[model samples]
Target chain A: MSGKSRRDFLKSTALIGAGVTGLTTTAKAGPQNILSEDRMGVLVDTTVCVGCRNCEWACKDAHNLPAGNLEDYEDRKVLDTKRRPGTDALTVVNEYSHGKNSSLPIDVKVQCMHCDHPACVSACIVGAFTKHENGTVTWDTDMCIGCRYCMAACPFQVPAFEYDKALNPMIMKCDFCFDRTKEGKLPACVEICPVEALTYGKRSDLIKIARDRIKRNPDKYVDHILGETEVGGTSWMYLASKDFAELEFPKLGKNPAPGVSESIQHGIFAYFVPPISLYALLGGIMWITKRRKELDEEVK
Target chain B: MKKFLALILVLVFTIGINAQQSPGKDHSKLNLSCKTCHSCDVPTKSDPCLVICPREKITTVYQKPEQTPELITINQLSDRYGPVYFSHKIHAQMSIMSGGCENCHHHNTSGPILKCNSCHETSRKREDVSIPDLKGAYHRQCMDCHREWSHETGCNSCHTLKKDLKDTKNESLQKKYSGKDHPVIIEPTKLVYETKSDKGKLVTFYHDDHTKKFGLNCTSCHKQESCTKCHDVNNTDKSKNQKVVTKKTFEDQHSNCISCHSKTENCSKCHGEKTLEPFDHGKKTGWALNKHHINLSCAKCHGSKLPYNKLDNKCLSCHKGWNAENFKHSITGLQLDEMHSELSCEDCHTDGNFGIKPSCDGCHDDYSFPKQKPGKLVK
Candidate 1:
């Protein structure tokens, strides 16, 4: 190869390496990963929810989705079939029959749990997902490559992919109304709930409130608080009359979801030792083969 | 000067002690246990260490339905909806058959009835979340019974949306409920029950006999009744043509009757082959009730005790105050003349047996009861 072309190629490679290192340094310094002590959270009291589905409509409207009239949500017949959050709708409320009283069904709103140690943030290949200090785990659409690694990693299976769209499909999930809350306004679902079953406040204060409710109404609610320690805790917690497993919540351990995979991946890539050693071994093999062939040619 | 200073200090100490001892309110007459309000053993005036809103332990202030406000406009938390026009008087009256004032005003103390907001904060994002916010409290109190009977959880049942207030219907509703009282409940005279008993299929209940003859209060048997017992909106149309028989446990079916009826009594007393007639005094006890006795409650003749005591057939048994002086002969439809006015009642009523006809054989042989004129036949 000519020396000039080789020099140009070497310059380009150095510039790319510098750019990658700069991006990694900035990501490490960003405040998005910090878990603030005063981060806000929401407490859902399932005992008080009336299965109105108003939260479902409010969530769609806030997210600029195709939400129909508010009166349409009053139709409880939709609750006959269970549903999960989709790309079109960011949240949904499902109904479960109360164990004691059949007339009063328990309604649970399903959405992104916004976990403290989010698997989506860890699994995103492009560094698109961010766990903000405000307890909101949001995804940036610009950096997404339609990998759908987040969908597989999520313990709650919250994030949905827009499979219908041929171009620029985005990952959708509840953003905890970060835009509205930034303006000192309440989340749409919490605002629209007629029963005030969803209470929003500091995460620390919310835990105290949830404990107080369970203490006050011992007979009305089960003692366990869902999402308190499940998957290393979540921004949204729940108080239910029956066990959360009965409400179709996935049973998970207290450890963070990405703990095992991240430990192995980070261990191999630490200080770039494994990749450097692999390249050195391959280079040594090629040199030995070339030297042997040269010696054979000389002997011939 | 030193002595005076010592005296002043003693007086100050005594006053301070007295202030600490009395909380200024008369808790002694409240009839409440100390632990109900106070978390600590010794609560002082400065630091009562009171439990937070001892709702179950507090004494509720009960006012008559008429004394309560007729209309209460709830606009404190109105945002998307207009103010709710609540008919407080009607609800208060309807509460009589259920749980009374304590049902809604569960946390009221022994004073003027406390408003719901006194304990329940108005803001949903308040610091203290031990109790529900005012909006939640109000909705829960209303929806508990309303949903039970009406099966409606729609907000439109109580609230009118701000955009839908263009018509005069809201005003008309406000006018309709203003100063309105719940209509008086009409009681049933008789109710017949078809029982599953093999001995007797028909069980007759004399409703009028219990209220008028036995003088049982409405609350005596209707304790803790749900509003759906009578005001079930879903069953209204169906119940009009057919009787709605609810399935109940055996204990529930006989609880009200067993409160008064003896457990050992024969089942045929209430249940028979056919519907039984109303109780007749003469047929049951052979003492036909007269005009005066018929109007009197059974409690007045027989003491207020259940399983009333029986009295012999003598006027003196009940009327111990009766005598010739106070007992006017004119009350018997016969006013004695001047000659017989001074005589004793025994002259006419032998052995105080006024149930029998008067005979003159005690006085003159020729003077029979009707043959001779006693008092010119006053009647």
Candidate 2:
């Protein structure tokens, strides 16, 4: 290709990168991305949970899903098999044998951790997911294009897709009971817990409560609070008697899940500097090489 | 008028000081160190500096099971279900073998038994999440043991759905448990355990002898027994059911006996080829228990400490208080006549050896005991 044509191509690419960078800088200032200090969170004390699946029933009922008789959930046989949150059930509780007491099994309610910096928010091509100021990561059904990138992006492997549906399949996950909380109500799971194992409060307050519980009952709970610093902190945290790994919690680093990808993508387009510089260097090299070839031909 | 105002101010100051000094609940009677409840050395009325929820350290006011109410209708926070009919007396009685009142009424001070709502908040949504709400507290206390023994976490196990209740008043339900008491626990007389010990296979435990004869309290051995130990709902036929022998550490396996029996003692002391008889003073120690000693508990002579110290066979060894003036001859089935009663006990008894038969040869010739008695038989 001619050097002149190559220079034109490089100029167009640089202009496009600058335009995209400008658009992203504007999007970052939106109200939906704010992380408020008083954002609500839930502290799940797994030691107190009694493996009653009432929370499962309550979740479906509150979400307007087809929840059968509450008594049906009392069949503990379902707990024998490990389960994940699916399109049908947004949240599930699993029982693990207690490390200290066999009779008292540890029941952990699994759902979206509602991370402070959600990967889904960053991964969504259409900007469908929003990390609200209140610590809930909610998705806009109308804006969602049925892309499964969110399912892959979630650190918890949450956000199940309706693969069975042929038309208008949607991503489903725990929304932290956004609608209920907007009306000044507790999340369905926390409200329905008979033992109040799930405590809901401000994110800052919940962390304090979680710390106090661990301090008071050192023997009853392991020192670590899962999701406190995991994936750059999650709205929902856990207190277990033993290590969280045994409970099937995904081991994750303290860094936010989207931190690496966001930084690289943003850095490459920031003020269009990197793209422009690379194009200028390539053009200079092409010009020199073409001049040297011409000079050799003249000598021959 | 100025002097009168000064007098009123003085009266108010004294009253304030009295109130500050006297906390409503008296801690003087409680056998607990100040550090148990208070974190600081000198806790003032304004800032008590009390330890927050010192649950393990606080002593519970234990009441006899019979003195407690037979049935309690827990109606607070009953929305989806009717009030639970809790058998308070039965639970209190069962708790004796476990942790007693402290198991449920944890964090109780020396004062009157505080209601559950005192510490546990009524609403689930509260400022402090350190302590569970009333609903959580009540359910945790019940389900901890109920789920263990019954293996059922169904709401129906403890509650009747509000819709299912025929009588909202629950008059019949109250009558069902009003005067009801837990049936008397019939303790086994003996238990023969087949052990894996090579020295001896059979280990006999005399339950009655430990409780009645040895004077051991039920709590001494059954301190932390689980509810599943006795109420095995899964085991329909107790006779046919084989106990799942859990692998316990050597110390845990012998904990109940090791408290009384020395750990250094020989294995054959408990493990034997056949079921050992209930502890017999004469057979085990060669000193026969007589009419007076037979009715007395073993602790009466051996002191309450276990592995009872052996006593030498001497009348004065145990009866140090007894002397010629204080000693009653009639109580020994013999009422000495005027002549014999006047003589000192040593004149006939010889060195106060009550275990040996008394001889008349020390006082008079041809007056042999049993043939010609010095005193008449009381009976």
Worst 10 residues of 1 chain B by lDDT: B237-246
Q: Across residues B61-159, which tens digit of lDDT does each residue of candidate 2 receive? A: 667887887778899989999889888888999999998888888877564577899779998777877778899889999988888888778898889
RMSD of each: 10.0, 8.7
DockQ each: 0.21, 0.43
Superposition error at A252 for model 2 (Å):
2.1
TM-score of chain B of each: 0.76, 0.77
* All candidates: TM-score: 0.69, 0.78
Ten contiguous residues minimizing lDDT sum, candidate 2 chain B: B237-246
Error of 1 at A175 (Å): 2.0
Instruction: Looking at model 2, give its docking quality level.
Output: acceptable
